[model samples]
Target: MYHYTDFDRQFIHQRAAQYRDQLERNLRGELKDDEFRPLRLQNGWYVQRYAPMLRVAVPYGELSSRQLRVLSKIARDYDQPSAAVYAHASATQAELGTPHLPVGHGHFSTRQNVQFNWIPLDKSADVMDLLAKVDLHGIQTSGNCIRNITSDALAGIAPDEDIDPRPYAEIMRQWSTLHPEFAHLPRKFKIAITGAEEDRAATAWHDVGLHLRRNALGQIGFKVLVGGGMGRTPVIASTLREFLPWDQILNYLEAVVRVYNRFGRRDNLYKARIKILVKAEGQRFVDEVEAEFAQIVAHDGGQHTIPQAELARVSKHFLPPALVQPAQAATTNIAFEFTDKEAADYQRWLHQNVHAHKNPALRAVTLSFKRLGFAPGDATADQLCAAADLADRFSAGEVRVTHEQNLLLPWVQATDLPALWLAARSLGVAKANIGLLTDMITCPGGDFCALANARSIPLAAGIAERYQDLDELFDIGPVDLHISGCMNSCGHHHTGHIGVLGVDKDGREWYQVSLGGSDGSSLSGEAVPGKVIGPSFAASEVTDVVEALLDTYRAQRLAGEPFIASVRRLGLAPFKQAANAVRHETRDGGQVLHVHLSTVDAATD
Candidate 1:
């Protein structure tokens, strides 16, 4: 866990004070909406569909229990819609055929951000003050600026790590934060980094991705990728540099963004991402970046080159906390026996939720937030505080927000598995569905987001409703069932094994189903975008269609093949035919319609 320095604390408190002034001025009518909009967005405030939304950045998904408690406080105190706002929002959603909107909860994103959907504008300053108290703020979480830097959730603890990428990610976080030159790019830019051989961070789908590795001479370097993104157009980033010295990463990153800032599209919002620029220019874009890098080095001597001492300073902050020190831990060789039924349940939980840690005595455990009723990744105020207490009791007072929308306790002793499992189960977060179908990656859809065409929460619920049988889920095996409200791909639906994108067809919600996409994880193999099967399915037909695709795989798959492998080996023809066969019109009020058709809700648990 990285501790905040005096400079960091001072900087954010000052920012909080400034935001208070700006917010007060806007409320007084001295600053109009247009002027206040950009200012608010810069601070991660958004005027969403029915209310103001706040996105709080959790750098690389790391959090201290104290910070989690503060987030819990914010959710309990500020994440509420006004009476009028709630009434209007409820009526609007009723017409849309979605479930009643839930409030006073924090939704964790695939990017490792916590979003509060119902916070009022007047209290935004108060929320900022609360966040600043814990050294948390929403800086650059929105707008055409470099967003929060994301990395592998198990960055410092992974067994396969070549170099812990946290220090480097922290370095970039410092460099990119409020950089005046790149403050207003053509559009939002994103970066992901990973030090492990496995691509758990999904770096291939980011604007700029870095893979940390050691060179032949044992010096650290990075393998860089540029232009990968998902939306209307999905691309796996091209290799920009095979090996960039670790020290010069900031300088090289500067050149890459510099070239993009100079040439990226401004006229068309649709074509504004760096992916478009890299695709349009191809080798020329790469060459231009290289030339810029040369110029930066030759003319200015690469002022951003990181020094060894500075790296050491940043690395020390990320070192394992005292609670994880093996010598200080209690050790015993006696193995506790379990009852047969207990053994069966505990083994399943261990297999699904526990991951290997570099430390032999330690294990990384994911607390499943995905269950019936609640939206995936959503934690209520009480749940958030419970998680904080769990972190304090079992995980060295630190919990990590995973990109898959779960909280990971990274320092649990292997011997404490039984006790932790019991505690997490009591907390209702031990669902044993880490990479299962029920553990779907989803975004707050039309119910909350103004940009969405459909609702994802209930759709996710609908799908989850059908998979209540743990035996059936484990039998089907690990699946990345990702959903997005729109083509924005905020849910990374483009890279899901089964990708579902919500679209508006004549003011009705329809879903496009795609197959054979992957996020480049070891389980998912090399990165590739999914291909749509056929015409978009009506919302009513989506759940049946998803079942049809899986049925198709089960019917055709070879022995021991997973869903993704079956999709690749069998091709999309049979799956397409099966999915299309399930599409049929449903009549509501004697009118042909694709109803929102969600079966799960906030009360489903």
Candidate 2:
């Protein structure tokens, strides 16, 4: 919601121009691939499996309708590979048993970023120019530097928010964007913040997590958690500080990142995360960070300390944008009347997708991008434009990209919910499946990412195709079913109640299933990594394995217990047995391995 100043506009345009020159030099052969690699990464361009991937940052998941339209334009005009590349990709997909690989579409990522997988590297400069015109860029969205700063999607508008975190996030954005000090750290760094009591942002899974809250005297400050991350090692962040005055947040962050820069591993890419360092050093790491903070305040004079005037300047930009509502808008319950079947569907959507806003007259509504045919989070260019149109009509020209890979209209007038729902339903995005099993968080695995060991999209598709009945989903209840291509955790599989991870075994695709992971929600209880059930299963058995796990839960759970609660209550023994029971071996002449409880538990253990 922050409007760009003239200086900001000029700065972005110059960056675009600079990138154009660099791209030109690289294309002319003056800059070699190795020389151009870091420069291209600085601008958020990556050479993925088949084509270039552009990661466009939606700052704290906020986007204007104008920006959305620009994104739609990019998807329509430029999100395509060359004919030869397309032909080869199609052939590859055909071999993989997936025909019609899509083009001219975009994916919403778990970190609240938008990704275009078909953009050509040669045409990237032109795309950068278009992004500059709309005050959007992908800078700091990639590379080993600090990536996008993420926060709760309902930052300022949440009913339980203690303070609007957008201002702080914006300030940090300005402070960290291309900082010479942290331009190249050991590995990618991430920070997530939340102001609400409920942990919607999954702050505990970030490298640096901040909780904006008040002390006993009502003085605002931050509860800082450091070294939390997911990869080979999943770690809940250690508390760096119980409370640091809000004014010194920037200063404290400086100290924390400075320590990581000095000590974090640079030799091995696999063990380079701050989580690894924190785990290895333990208390020593905490002592080092505190000492660094003391040094920054004493010797550095806390140059990054935020002044009240500066904070106010940023805070005013995030105030509710102009939203006009009916004079007598319904504040209690929706007043829409419908026939029996119609009313049942509308009530399901209202209960699942509509969320309370701080303003009594406004509501936040999520447009479900999870449906049949298309992969989760994949939206075509036409759908993007349609979403922009819906935002313009209902949300005061603003839309939010949520961490769940869906678009949220944060300014929907409470009384206009009926009309908005009708329009969204027409777009086929009103599945009323928010938090349900079908609303999975998935990544474009081996299909697009070169780093992926196996494909994630088709697995997600298979599961979705199997569970089309709304009654079944409602019965299963809220569960985070996250899938990832590899250890990068792009789809955040480690935090899912039922985690699906794609891996490569003997040059063939295999999947490992994990259970009981939580993302630190009130429903999840705490942020914890899931435990593996048993040996990796063949791709053919994954769906059956999931069915077996769910079946075990269904048979054993107490009345009305959610899937995650059941998995927690009855340890992993029953689920592991269930998962292995139906797992038919595809290797060694298709022999079946009968698994007993002792062998199953021992295999996983």
Candidate 3:
């Protein structure tokens, strides 16, 4: 909701102009492929498997109606022809009250950004121009620098939130954007912040995670966690600083990254992440960071302090809207009526997609992009526009993108729930499965990404199709089934209750399974790294394997036990047995060798 100042707008346009020149040069053959690769990547352009992919950053996952319209326009006018079957403009244009243009739709990613898969290199500059029109850009979205900072999707509105993390996130954004020292690092760094009771932002798995909590005196601050990441080496971040005063956040962050930049490995690209550094040094890493913070504070007489005016400036932009009525009073007073079908459908959605808001009169609704048959996070241009229109009508013209690859209408009145659900259903986004198995987090695997060792979308589809029955999913209960095409962990498989990672074994596509992983939300221990169940499964058996695991959970779980809790209690032994039973089916009247349980090789591509 933070509008750009004149200085911010001017700075973004200038950067766009610079990138446009670089793109023009590259296209004219003045720059060779190798020479232009870094330039293009810095601007978020990648030559994917079938076509070019451009990722556009959505800061803190927040979008205004105007920004959403701009995204729809880009999808209409510029997306390549092959993926533009539903790229009609009249419907979206009508909703946006703008002119109809022919283009393609965009895919939202788990990182809370939009990616256009079929963009042409020639149109890169044009895309940049379009994004700049809405005060958005792709800078820092790619490269070995800080990527977009993520927070809880329901950040400001969550009922149990101690403080809104956006102002601090924005402040960090201002400090980290194009910071000269960190422009190029040994590996890309990521940061996440969460102010809610639950770790909705997956703070435990980030390079830097700021968990805000109130002290005994009711002053808000952060519980800083560092070195947690997933890749070849998956590690939960250790507590770097237990309770960092809110005012010194930037200063503390500066010290942490500074230490990393100075000592982080640069020889091996695979082990260059801060996580590796933390692992190697252990307690010594924490000591070094604390020492650095002291030095910084001592120098220049505590000069890195955040100004109260600056905090106020960012905080004003995130002020909650006035509530229409108290939620309890409204629910009690409303004369509600519903048809049988409507009541049943609405009830399912209300239970799955709606979340409590701090403002009792308002509820946050998740508009799921993970409908059956579509890619997990993709939304057609019309769907995007329809969401924008619905947000304008019901949520005061604001929408949020969740780190789980879903869209959230953050401030809908309780009274408008039925109308919003109906409209969302028409757009094919009302799937009534927010935390269920069908609501998976997946990456664009071998189908599009060149780095992928196996296709992930098909695997995700197969799994979703297997569990399409809502009754079965509800029975299964809350489970995080995350799949990644490779060890890059773009899909965050390392944090799922049921984790699946694609691999290439002897030039054949296979998938490895892990269980008991979580996204850092538990009454007990959370963010527990998953253990590999057994050997990799063939593409054909992926669904069968998932079914076997779920079936085992259904049979073994205690009453009302969640999938994660079941996994923790039962351990990997039961799931491993189920997977092994399914993996050794006789083929062509021949007995196949059963895969033995072993540690997953992180080095596998």
Q: Which one wins on lDDT?
A: 1
Q: Indicate the worst ten consecutive residues by lDDT in candidate 2.
A: 596-605
Compared with the true structure, what per-residue lDDT tens digits does model 2 show for residues 547-583?
7888898899899899999998999999998887777
| Candidate 3 global CA lDDT score | 0.82
Those runs of model 1 whose alpha carbons end farther than 4 Å from true positions after fitting are 324-340, 584-605
Per model, how many backbone clashes are there? Answer: 0, 0, 3
Question: What are the lDDT scores of the predictions, listed in order?
Answer: 0.88, 0.87, 0.82
Arrange candidates, best lDDT first: 1, 2, 3
What TM-score would candidate 1 get against the native?
0.95
C-alpha RMSD of candidate 2: 5.1
TM-score of 3: 0.92
* Better-scoring candidate (TM-score), 2 or 3: 2
